[model samples]
Target: MNTIHFTNLPDDLPVAENEEQKKQELEFLKSAFQTFNETTRHLQESYDKLQERLNALDLELEAKNLELEKNLQEKERVKNYLNNILESLTTGVIVVDKNTRITTFNKTAGIILGMTAGQCLNQPLADTGIQPLAELVQSSGGQTRMEDHEITTRDQRQVHIRLSASPVQDPAGHRMGTVLILQDITQLKRLEEEAQRNQRLRAMGEMAAGIAHEIRNPLGGIELFASMLKKDLAQDPEKRPLTEHIISGVKNMDRIISSLLLFAKSPEPSRQQCNLNHLLKDIVNASADFQCPDNVKIHHDLAVGEAVAAGDEELLRQVFLNFIRNAVQAMPDGGSLRLTTQTGNTADSRSHITVTVADTGVGIAAQDQKNIFNPFFSTKDKGTGLGLAIAHNIIKAHQGTIDVESETGQGTKFIIKIPAWDEN
Candidate 1:
């Protein structure tokens, strides 16, 4: 407004200053670009390192997972394998933890103890209701391990058992629990006793046979003389009874001697297919011959199927006749008699023919039962006492077993098992 001047005024303005300002702005932009490039490079390097670390962790985790699964599978396989071995043992096996809790109970153990796994497993052994086993384990007077120890069951069956106990230990040898092994030996004991009895009887039989022969010679002469005397006294009626008494006494003595000889004899049984049902029926029908009373009732349950025995028919007839006669004699006051026949399996699962004779009568005493098969051990007031002994010997010869069960007043049962007739 006051009259402007043209052209170059001051060197500090416009051209030179503009050039310097542009130079400074270019330098600052360059410095800022370099700083941004360095920051981006550092960020990229850190991301690469983080990615590598994550990938390494995933691989380690995968391997660890595979090993864990493999260990789980191995453990399961071992558990099942152990379970199978525990189940198949015939001897009774019972395992209890340190806390006295039942951990394992096998099938044979269940059978012998008369209990099931559901009733015993995880329970206290003392509370499982097997008192004899518990007493043998827990009682101070009892032994933890013993052989051929005898005990009575709740069902009143006497059992012989061989038992052993051992400690269960962990892999580290720490006491974990106790394991008990048991075996039932009642049959073996009975067999041994029978063998001993047979040996004694054999010796007695040899002596009795000799004595019987000696007596028989004199007995025959006595009977012959009595008969002659009876003939001479036939006309004298007063002396007839005296000669009759002598003859009667001689006849009785002869009968006893015959019985003694019969008991002493043990012939090997002649085997034949004898239908036990038919044989028993015949004996029952002819029970009158054995003096079966009119007041006594007889019941028969013969098997519908064939119940055949492998023994001599004549011997079987005699054995059954003895049984029926003894049964009739036992029930003097009139009671029931039951005869049954069945084809079945024995304890070891062998085929057998069972003949049961049960009578409601005055039963034999428990003490007397132990000696009932011994010769000259009579239950009757007037008997030779050789019937049962002879019957026992005959059964043994026939490869059969005879057992008697009796109580003082309850009743008596005779069980006879013979080998079933096998064509093979």
Candidate 2:
């Protein structure tokens, strides 16, 4: 192999003019080739470094994509779990966008409003046809929290509902939308009204007790004087008849006063472990004097198990007697009076004995059911309206509960539950 050396080139060689010029050009070409080789070597090294950097970036991008996928899956799972919880909740929940369009509605909200989520979503409140709710939200001015609003449904059924709405915002405080929560409070409202009624009845009972006591002594003396006056006027037949009528009327008023006194004076319960079945039998026998119409048949289903309760025997008897009397009155034409006893456990797992008095009679109207226990509130003209009221008070004093269920013309059932004493 022949290698060209730059230093070996002749500076001035004797030759023809053309030959000398060619030699100079050849030497310059050799020098330029050496500089080109050095440039190529530098570029090859830079290309190798760039390829390594590109490979590193590619691997980093793959890792980042995998991490993003994992985060997305986690977020999806969390969203589904939260959605399931919201759907299962009993309280109704609805979310609306800033434009008043429905964004989300849970299953409970759908059921409560009598519409499906698909029908409600993305629709304006007005278009949904819930007029009361739409008007309320429109009046809220983007936010409202209302408690215990009474509303009637399309079916004309009254309901007490609580509403709460708050504006939803993003983390940076940007207005997003609104969230509404709804809760049914009809039963709670009824309970509050019942408590107030019971308070008033209690006050009345106390006052009646004082008045009856003061009037009873005078009434007894008057009855005695009237009887004596009638006996003295016996010789005068016309006068005797008039005096006897007065005596009889006065006696009837005195009897009513005595009964009022007995009701107002709540005797201390002589509590003992007593069989409720026996007590119920006694009540049935005593109620016969009320002259229940012939069409009314009485049936008893006493539990074979321990039908035991710790309460005053006489008071409990009176309670059942009052209930039976009411049932008889409800069915003027007569109906079936079925008495049943069952032993069960309470929600808290405490043992209880339940006595039920059911009647096939003209059932109480739903509107009047809530106030049935209020004193002086009665459906019957002949009733003083104190029977059921006093019965309720007696049951309450016994640490028991009396619940009634009735539908108009269907029937009425009263369940009295009393806790069983500890079997110590």
Q: For all candidates, what are the clash counts?
A: 0, 0
Give the clashing pairs for model 2. Answer: none
Tens digit of lDDT per residue, candidate 2, span 20-135?
Answer: 77777787777677767767777788888888998999899999999999999999999999999999999999888878799989998876666788888899966776665666
lDDT of 2 at 138: 64
Range of the 10 consecutive residues with the lowest summed lDDT in candidate 1: 1-10
TM-score of each predicted structure versus truth: 0.74, 0.74
In model 1, pairs of residues that clash are: none
For candidate 1, write residues 1-424 as lDDT tens digits. 1222233334565887878866766776676667777777888898989989989989999999999999999999998888788778789899888776899989877776667889889999888655655655554232246545776654566668777767777999887777778788888988898889899889888899999899989888988888898898889999889978887888888888887788888867899999998998887776455656798999989988899999988888878888888888888899999999988898888889989999998999977987889888997888778888889989888888998998877789999999999998
lDDT of 2 at 367: 83
